[model samples]
Target: MLKLAVAPVPYHWPRARILSFYADLAKAPCEILYLGETVCAKRRALTPQDWLDLAETLRAAGKEVLLSSLSLIEAASEVSTQRRLCAGSEFLIEANDLGAVTRLRGREFVAGPGINLYNPRFLTRLHALGMRRWIVPIELSRQGLETMQAHCPVDVETEVIGWGRLPLAHSARCFTARVQGLAKDECALSCADHPDGLVLYTQNEQPFLCLNGVQVQSALSHCLIDAVETLQQLGIHSLRLIPQSEGFDAVLRTFDQVRRGATTASSAVEALGRLAPTGLCNGYFHGISGMDWVAPPQVPQGQASLDAPAPRKQ
Candidate 1:
């Protein structure tokens, strides 16, 4: 059976909201819960101890927990924090960067999505360094994964972003801070105001992307409700669902039902619209433009433009 893991929160949620979110998740069908901040280090709504405390709580509920590290190591203090996260033995560490990988060489760890493991040889090296599983990057298409999976190093598991707004890029510059005309160091933590993320639009008023501190995500939510069978055929081990502000619990139930053949993909997609902030896209999974959605067996390519407006439920 394919396991479902809830990926770490990518947005700057309030501390109380974060606690409340997991409290609900403690009974969700998700088998694994990725705990900790993998985005900006400045979003300190939950400290290290707080994350560990949450992890302990989830584990007591029989959920497997993993701690994720920031994708970018910006400063010395961030590196030190990464070191501390890797030093712990209670939970699996999702290594999003080389620094985390270096610290977790001897320990069984998960290679997170941000770590660019493109080829089998590179993945093999990570496997040698105790990478038990690897979260396939958001850009890799179905064909790309099939090729890579054929040559997967020993005992390594594969996971993909099943649904949610795709995290497209990260930068050293704090976009939310810059938007406020404030310096990175002196700017107030403004990302918390937009729990989902600060939306970005083009001059034509077309929604293009979202700015969550240093991370820029695609405006179109990347969904794979229709790809569950393909995943099973490919020997994929897990599906990772990134946390969103609303409708996530329902999303979990829908995906589980779809995976089990209890619901049609069309029905699940109907329910999915209520969960995604924008209309869905799976183009990158089809070897097309990442902004498009391509259904299998020669279903006509549907181009989901960057200006795709958030969908409303009927």
Candidate 2:
């Protein structure tokens, strides 16, 4: 059976709210939970120890926790932080960057979505170094995954981003701060203002993208709640669900019900729409553009309902 994992908090939530959120996750159906900061270095809503503290609570709740590393390494301090995360993390490390993998070379780790695993040879090299599970990058099509898994080690687990806005790109410069006319250095913590991430719109008022500190994301929510069978057939073992600000618990429940056969895929898709209401996109899975919602034939049959997007309040 495939595992249902929750990625770390991508939004810049307040410390208190973050604490409360994980406390609630104790009751959620999440089997695997990836913790720690993976986005901006400035969003220090929780300290290393604070995250570990929550890890203990989550583990008690029967969730396997993993510490995630930053995707973009900007400075020596960040390198030091990654090394420290690998060395001291109570749980296995999720290597978003190669440097994290280097630090965790002799130990087990999950390859995060930031790493490109398109080449089976490259994946083989990582598997030799202790990559137990690999998260297929958001852009790679299902065909790419099929090819990689054919040659990779049998023990290597495959996980995919099942939902949430796809994190597209990351840079040293903070676009969220830049748009607000603030330098990355002296900019206020503006990310805290837009908890779900600051929405970026096109000139014609179409949803274009979103800004989450240094990370750029898709405007439409990426979903695969309807593609459970495809994932199972592809030999994938985990569905990584990124945390959203609202309707997160519902998202977890819906995915769980769908995966466990308790509810139909159509019913799960409806629940996801109500919980999030953001337009759905599954193009990347079909080897097309990342912004289109092209569901496979085996998935539930229905027009995706995204009438009310999650409010973008400051």
Candidate 3:
């Protein structure tokens, strides 16, 4: 059975809200939960020990817990945090950067989407170092995944980012800081002001990208609720749902129903639309551009289809 894993929250929220959010997640139907700071090191909403404590709570509730490392390492403090995450024996570690990969020498780890795993050689090296599973990079198309999977060891678990805003790139320079007339070094945690991320717009008032501290993401959420069947056919072991501010519980339940064959893909997609901040997208899965939506030829005859129109490029 395909499992549901909630990726760690990317934006920084208030401490009280963060705690409440996790408490709610504890009751959600997700089987796996990733905890820890995977973005800017200065967020400080949760310390390393704080994340471990949350992991313990989730583990007690029969959820598999994985600790995530920062996507960009800019300071000695960040490197130390990575080492501490790698040293922990209590939970699985998700390495988001090459620096984390280097420190996770003999331990089992997860190659996060940020780590470049475009070729068989890279996968082989990680496998040799005990990489148990990996999430495909957001830009890699379905055909690319097929090629990589053909050469991947059968025992290695393959996961995909099935939901949430597509994380495009990460950098040492904070774009949000620039927007606020602040430098990356002196930026006073401006990301917290926008729980879901500050929306960037084009000159004509069109939504473009989202600025989440040092990470830049697609304005439209990359949704694959309608691609569950195709993902299963491609031998994907699990579907990852990145945490957002709202409707997460409903999102998990919808995916669960679709994965269990209790609900149709289109039905799940419609349910997702009612819950997500933006409309769903499956372009990256169809081998079209990352923003296009190519409806499946067969739509379970007579069922009401809820597919999106073809994408219009900006």
Candidate 4:
């Protein structure tokens, strides 16, 4: 059966906000939740112990919890913290970088999307290293996934990011700090000001990307509400929805409805379009530009646009 999972928050939210968010999420319908800071280490509103405690609370609420590590490790302190997170928890760790994978050898771990497991051979090697599951890299197309699965020799749970902005890249330098004219080390937790991430625009005033501390993301949220059937056909085990600042509960309900056959994919897509103000894109999944929005097959081509506004409530 295909399961629904929530990814860790990729932005810097205040401690109280984080606590409140998880308190609400504890009752959410998703079967799995990832907890921890995955971006800059300086944005530690919650201590490592706080994340573990939250994970326990969610677990008691019937959700599987995993601790996620930083995608870009730049300091010895960050490495030490990650080491503690991996060693101290009974929960599985989501290894975002190669170092995490090396540290997690002989233990079951999840290969996060940041790790590039492009081909069958690499995946097999990781499986040998005790990778029990992996999220498909956002840059990989559906066809690419299908091809890899057809040739893969091991059995592992496969997951795809079903919603939220695509995390395109991570850097050692903080873009948010640079934008605020502050040194990286002196960044005043500016990322907390934009819980959904600070948007970066193009020369033509087009919304291009989002700068969340060190992580760069697609300005438009990625939606695969229309692709549930396709993903199931390809034997994907889980659909991961990254948490956003707002409307995430509705997003989860929409995906769950579609997965349960209570709603049609078209209707779900239409309803979801109203939730994402910057519109939705499945272009990366369809092997196109990550910013481009492709309409479902039932809808005519060109019906979807990058600048699409959320539909008004009738």
Model 2, range 1-314, lDDT digits (tens) per residue? 66899998988999998988888888888789889889987789898888888888888888888889988998888888888888987698899998888888789988998897789888888889999998998888878878877886889998989999889999889988998899998878898998888888889877778899999988778888877777888788899898888889988988888888998876676567556535667788879888876643444345333233243332
Worst 10 residues of 3 by lDDT: 305-314
Question: What is the C-alpha lDDT profile of model 3 across 1-314, one tens digit per residue?
Answer: 78899998999988788889889878887788888888888899977788888889878988899998888887998888788788765688899998887888888899999888889998998999999999998878888999988999987999999998888888878988899999888899888888888878789965667889999987767788777887889889999998888788888889999898998876676577666565556678767667555544555655334355332333
* Candidate 2 C-alpha error for residue 47, in Å: 0.8
Candidate 4: clashing pairs of residues: none
Q: What is the lDDT of residue 178 in candidate 2?
A: 92
Ranked by lDDT, the better of candidates 2 and 4 is 4
Q: Which ten residues in a row have the lowest lDDT in candidate 4?
A: 305-314
Give the Cα error of residue 158 in candidate 1, in Å. 0.5
Clashing pairs in 3: none
Give the Å shift of residue 145 in candidate 2: 1.7
lDDT of each: 0.85, 0.83, 0.82, 0.86
Q: Rank the candidates by lDDT, best first.
A: 4, 1, 2, 3
Clashes of each: 0, 0, 0, 0
* Winning model by TM-score: 4
Off by over 4 Å in 2: 295-314
Ranking by TM-score: 4, 1, 2, 3
Model 3, residue 154: C-alpha shift (Å): 1.8
Residue pairs in clash, model 1? none
Model 1 worst lDDT window (10 residues): 305-314
